[model samples]
Target: MEELSPTAERLVSEFVRTTRRQGAVPSRQVADRTLELLRQLVSEPGWRQTAQLVGQLRAAGRQLAAELPTQPAVGTLVCRLLKMAREEHGAHDEVHEARPHGAPPSQVDSLHRRLTAGRGAAPAADLSSELTGLRANLLAGLDELQTELDASADNIAREALSHIHADDVVLTAGRSATVLAFLRRAARERAFHVLVVEGAPFGGGHRAAAELAALPRRVHVTVIAESALFAMMARVNKVILGVHTVLADGGLRAPVGTQALALAARFHSVPVIVCAPSYKLSPQFHRGDQQEGFLESVSPESVLPYADGALVGRARLTCPLFDYVPPELVTLFVTHTGGTSPWYVYRLLNEYYDQQDHEIVQV
Candidate 1:
């Protein structure tokens, strides 16, 4: 994986290898799983084992777009290419006033004119070939993305947890596993209580609270509304949440109330913590230095009332769906490998992408 294009392939392969060893996935299914995982993995800076594909976008200009989208660097590359095209065209047009008397356009400028001209605006054959290559690379990379994602998740969950003393309130939402982790350690000494929230709409918090409730008597379950969660923040000592996206500026995109929750906790002097697998750590981010998040929604009918004809009625509906919590609000991220802050995530991306720099060439 010495080239930009190969980054996708290498990532898929590495994820497959890791997952297969963990028994999290089968060998036969690894290929297909990795494909879907890489596409998503490259879009965030959460669980990446390598660097942030910073220069991988150059592949598009190198005529590798045909196979670049699915590659680890394709997402970044496509974004870069789009911006590059705009920039290059902007400069070209700015300097494109009628040629000075007797002055001929530069060779490159002449080619540009030819490309823009109707008679030779573009080469259909070349374009067709490039498109085909792009599709091939995309599909190839998608094939391994999923497997990598799941496997990476499982592997990250396997890391041993250090003990956090009792008389502590761990505030967390989403990822039932990480919460269980904190509770498990608490159960060892039987002294900690847990304050959980319902990640409404999807409400992963409901699931989390339930799981913790059944974990013995020491873990207390506090199911609070999105609004009330902030008001009750002073009671907790630690805040742990999940990451939806790791933005470019070393921030995180978590559930909506998470930022509010984190902020409230911060006011009370709480040491917030996040537990996740290392694979969830990625190097891909955009829009300034901050991480971005996409709030997934469910069927609209979910909000419909169950009262007579109410569910099917157009009169009333209730669904706020999901929200993104910025990383600045996060205190520490706990991965199976270890716990670290968002700033450390940047270095992880650098390392991962560095390994993938040359090896990530498009197929």
Candidate 2:
């Protein structure tokens, strides 16, 4: 794959983090909110967020499918919810009078025109320039979130280590919750030495490992087998993981091995923690109580050169890029907002929506 631009990568990473926090399920309110943020990144206003939201929506549909409930409740419920959100937040008829009912980029120019119609717009005032400056300010505010994430990362790491004695090790899943927070605090505390599990096909954990490595603090990376997780428990004192979704009830859907590791950690008296950004924490759950599966596949054609015997009867291979880790296995959720128990995710969602809904105003 071609390398992604830093900005684009950051956007995707943030999305990934958001999805983990929101849980695998997609809800209309959460989707609508996410769409708005993505819109800010593109020129088409809602168009970009619409496209970006599609991935999570599809994932939601798939999760709903997994429950296989004959009742069809998932479709009916979510559709109703989505329709309600659209009616409320989707799009509104513009007030042609233009005192500013809305000023999405698609309509900003028209609004600007209305403000200056037949009036020679101020020669020195550039509407686009003004918009650009405003957008910059908005982006700067969002960028400040990085500092919170940094702090959360270190805090989680420290908390994870709190129950741990020196020389004891910890292993975490692919970006389990609050890894960013732990790293942030870890860097600030001048922490050195971190071992990360490289999640394959994507190896997102490597991103954290790389960031940690760059912190002027010593950090290390080691790839381990999914099968060996339990066996290695003795050396690991804590397990830190990132999450994609945290349900209203506090259940989580993360990478596959996560649940197993959480169980193992509990068995071994190890604390399992999550690091996450605040944008994540939406109270949505996958359709049906069931978790979603990762769509993965291995190339059958790649082994063609080896012949049928070497190919071991010529079976195709498949791989999963993600997994659904349950919330009960987690001990704490480290977020920019603060450390929360799994159940607190619902409360976090309520608070986030309360703030987000009022954040954008016509004025």
Candidate 3:
């Protein structure tokens, strides 16, 4: 097992403590912090090879994942950084090695080929000499990733006009910063009505409605109870929501009641569009048997107040913070890059993450 440096360990520990104290930190904020930590780790002295840096990052990622099991963004960002480091190293090695001028570019082998290939010890190399310019390349890659993260909301907002149009009644639940940006951008040109289902216990939808109503542009906003979601679905033209994490199998781990909202949209034949960034794409699969760790339970006091003494002592209350919506219920995912169907999530995962590093945090 590899160990984390003193700086890395201290940073990881502080992050865990902060997140624990202040629950439900936004995924984007978590990703930004994680990226900065990785930048510091890369710039730290004494790393002679890419492999050493990768090992330290893996260790730090596992620590974060263990301490903050609910925050998948931490693991996702770590996996991306690992891939970037490997690519930078590979690019350097390819530059040094000689190849035929007319040789075709190497093809990415399919999973079938990888499975059938014989397992053998990887060739060892003295990467210490090959470390020239690797740090600069990695820093550049990190800068590019940070830029992408920062611009994700704007990029997704740019496509709002294509999805939303004049006189369309948009239905949404919970308060998502990305969803708000999307709607606000569309309202600049097109006039539309927004129906917000008040997310119970938290009332995030009410906040969303208030914010939308306060916008300078004209946007009709209505706050409805969760019970009215199904009734209002028939009149809704589209359903747009934000996600907590996008699972590998194209499923959604979103705020509670999102599954019901998607079901209502599907019943009415309305499109369910999810506004999320690429960093929220998680490579982990959520299985029925793994609910113990994957599903988070917050305080039950919100649902069953302690003032109701008799019920509080006798009745059991489980306040799950999220719901899982399978791929079949989701129509499309609107990412920063562009729109993609649920079925193509695996390809995005392959592009953003390395296969071997997918389970780095799990280890």
List lDDT for all candidates, in order: 0.49, 0.48, 0.84
Candidate 3 Cα lDDT to native: 0.84
When 2 and 3 are scored with lDDT, the better candidate is 3
TM-score of each: 0.52, 0.50, 0.91
The numbered model that scores best in lDDT is: 3
lDDT of 2 by residue, 293-335 (tens): 2343345444253466666564656444345556667788766
- Which residue ranges in model 2 land beyond 4 Å of their true spot? 1-168, 175-181, 187-193, 201-215, 219-223, 287-317, 354-363
Q: Could you list the CA RMSD of all candidates, in the order they appear?
A: 14.6, 14.4, 2.8
TM-score of 1: 0.52
Q: State the TM-score for model 3.
A: 0.91
Q: Give candidate 3 regions above 4 Å deviation.
A: 94-130, 361-363
Q: How many backbone clashes does candidate 3 have?
A: 0
**In candidate 3, what are the lDDT values of residues 230-348, reduced to their tens digit?**
99999999999999889888998888899999988999999999998998898888777356344677888988889999978899888988888999999999999889999999989
Candidate order, lDDT descending: 3, 1, 2
lDDT of 1 by residue, 1-363 (tens): 123445454554465455546652222243344334435434533312221232333332233323222222333333422232223332334354664655544444446645787764343111111111332344344444444444544444443234365566666765455456556655656566666677766677788777777765546677777777777777776676655444444565455566677778778888777665433343545443121123233455544645547436646543433344456666777664566776787755542332223232222
